[model samples]
Target: MTDRSAAGTTFDDFVAARSTALWRSAFLLTGDRHKAEDLLQVALVKTWRRWDRLTGGVEPAEAYVRRALVTTYTDWWRRRWRGEVPTGELPERPTTGRDGPGAVDVRRDVLTALAGLSRGQRAVLVLRYFDDLTEQQTADVLGVSRGTVKSQASRALAALRSSPALTDHDHPATEEEPS
Candidate 1:
């Protein structure tokens, strides 16, 4: 259905073009594929409800949706619900023949480290690094000061570096300066 809005873009068209990227951001924010899908759906529905209000069209709508996604994730984290509990046994990861075991290991390690971060810290990292948003933009999205964004990102990176999952083995050694 070609349901075009006043902004000259159909919701379907917007979703078709942007859903994958949105989903990736959601996954990184939530640290689960299933939760990512749920979060994206919720954000998209919220965006669609006010799609016409986004006068700048798709770009503005995307920004709005991204902010909604982050806000929703933060809300979810705050709600201390007894959600799904993990068992002692780890689940098997599906591997693509293209990426080697090392790649998978690094990816897993990074995700684990990210999951350990506080919601605000994780949101800052995802928006700043993954979404490639400027510090000002990230602060605007999170409704915090630019300094807060910088501090959060710094703390997040420091935590990641010190995480056992992403230790010296996972990183390349830098050359030492001669004293």
Candidate 2:
């Protein structure tokens, strides 16, 4: 079956090329693999609905999809359901020794720190640092001013530094004696 959008490119082709990157961004934004998958799916569906209107090519289409993802996430944050009850019990861990200790620990700590951030702060950090977007680009993505992006990034970094899971108290002070 031929899979082609109105832009003369197949949706499958676009997904094949960019799905991994999109999924990574989604994971960073959502902080949970399952939520990330759902977020990506919803964004893609929204993008597909308006695929034909995405002129100028794949880049524009990707931009539209990213905007959809961010907007959808923001909407979800606003209407977050409070009906779900949290269980105090911790889930059983599988003893899989695949990743290196340092790498695994760092990844876990980073994700935990990210989870500690507010939605806007987390979005800014993910877009500016993890996605490697410029301040202006991040602002554009989140539909905010560059100044807002800068402030959010600053606050997010401060929060991360203060996170007990991410802080390194072992470092010695480097202050020099006054001359």
lDDT leader:
1
Q: Write the per-residue lDDT of candidate 2 for residues 120-175, one digit (tens) a residue.
A: 89899888887788998888889999999999998887777667665643322234
Candidate 1 global TM-score? 0.85
Model 1 over residues 1-179: C-alpha lDDT tens digits? 36647389888888999999999999888767788999999998898888777886788888899999999998887774226332222344777787666655666767777777888999999999999999999999999999999999988877777777667355422334256
**Superposed model 2: Cα runs more than 4 Å off:** 81-103, 168-179
RMSD of 2: 4.6
